[model samples]
Target: MPRYLFLKHYRTGQTPHPNAADRWTPQEISDHMAFMDAMIEDLKANGQFVGAEALSPRGTFVRYGGEGKPPVTDGPFAETKDLIAGWMAVDVESEEEAYAKAAYLSSAPGYGGRPLYEWIEVRPFLSEADTPDLG
Candidate 1:
């Protein structure tokens, strides 16, 4: 099975819900989270769920320094356009399956119980088994 990563960016890609989540009501936020949880449960039941994580907007970009030196970073950058809201990893039999799953996830409800219709970035993992033969 090939593993795919679904990247959920914050207000960067196309989406019906353009407003920030903070603008939504508390109940709306809860509803959105509930939908996400239910989706994960469904994926788990199908044995396609590998893992999922919700990221904090505050992210630090770290780069390798010289030996025995601290990594260099420009401090936390929480720019909404550059922040990734989260990611979901799924192991499936085909790329189509991955796309289907991502599409379903993109429909997660947002403000006013409306489908977000968000754009999800999907990419498959390259494992040793997928390495091309050079001989």
Candidate 2:
């Protein structure tokens, strides 16, 4: 079995949805959340749902200040352009299955029963057991 990550990226200050979530009707928002919940449940049922998570848009970049100093941060730099909205890591039997799942995720609902065709980056995890020794 191999694991893969479905990276879902979002543009900061860029509208992912023509009608942003905040602008959606309360019922529309609820429906959107419900859709996500159902998707997760479906994945779990298939035993391919390893994990998923969402990231906050407001986060800062931290770096070491100096040898004797503390960490330093310029501020919430990720807010400037792009953001990794969230990701779903799954353990599946094949690459095609992973790709299928990624494709399925792209059809999430947006406004008025319309589909949000967001682009997803699908990548596989390196399986140490499957790798050949160089030496």
Candidate 3:
């Protein structure tokens, strides 16, 4: 079984299923998270889940000069052209399985209990024979 990484990118030029995030009520948000938790539990029970996590929207990019020099951060890095919201790693038997999981995740509940239709990037880990430059 090979491992695949599913990346969830933050906001972009694309439009959300519902119009805006603020449209979602508190209970709707809770319900959405509950759905995600249930999916994780189900995946675990089936022995197909490896791990999953989300990243904070805000982060600092650091540049180090030397051991004695402190890292520096510029405010512009707060939001870049592409912000990766989060990701999920899964060890599956086939590419179809990975795509299936991605599709399922994309169907997560959104405002008014509709699907989010989030785009997930599915990438496979490079095997020893796949990477020629690593050596």
Instruction: Give the Cα lDDT of each candidate.
Output: 0.86, 0.77, 0.78
> What lDDT score is found at residue 51 in candidate 2?
92
User: Model 2: which residue pairs collide?
Assistant: none
Where model 1 places Cα greater than 4 Å from the true spot, the runs are 13-17, 65-70, 129-135
lDDT by residue (94-131, candidate 1, tens digit) is 99999999999998888787888888899999898889
- The count of residue-pair clashes in candidate 2 stands at 0
The order by descending lDDT is 1, 3, 2
Alpha carbon deviation, residue 62, candidate 3 (Å): 3.1
- Give a tens-digit lDDT track for model 2, residues 29-74: 6786788789899989988788988776666778999999988987
Global CA lDDT of candidate 3, please? 0.78
Which candidate leads the pack in lDDT? 1
Tell me the TM-score of model 2: 0.77
What is the Cα-based lDDT of residue 84 in candidate 3?
77
TM-scores for the candidates: 0.83, 0.77, 0.78
What's the ranking of the predictions by TM-score, best on top? Answer: 1, 3, 2
Model 1 scores a TM of 0.83
Off by over 4 Å in 3: 14-23, 64-77, 133-135
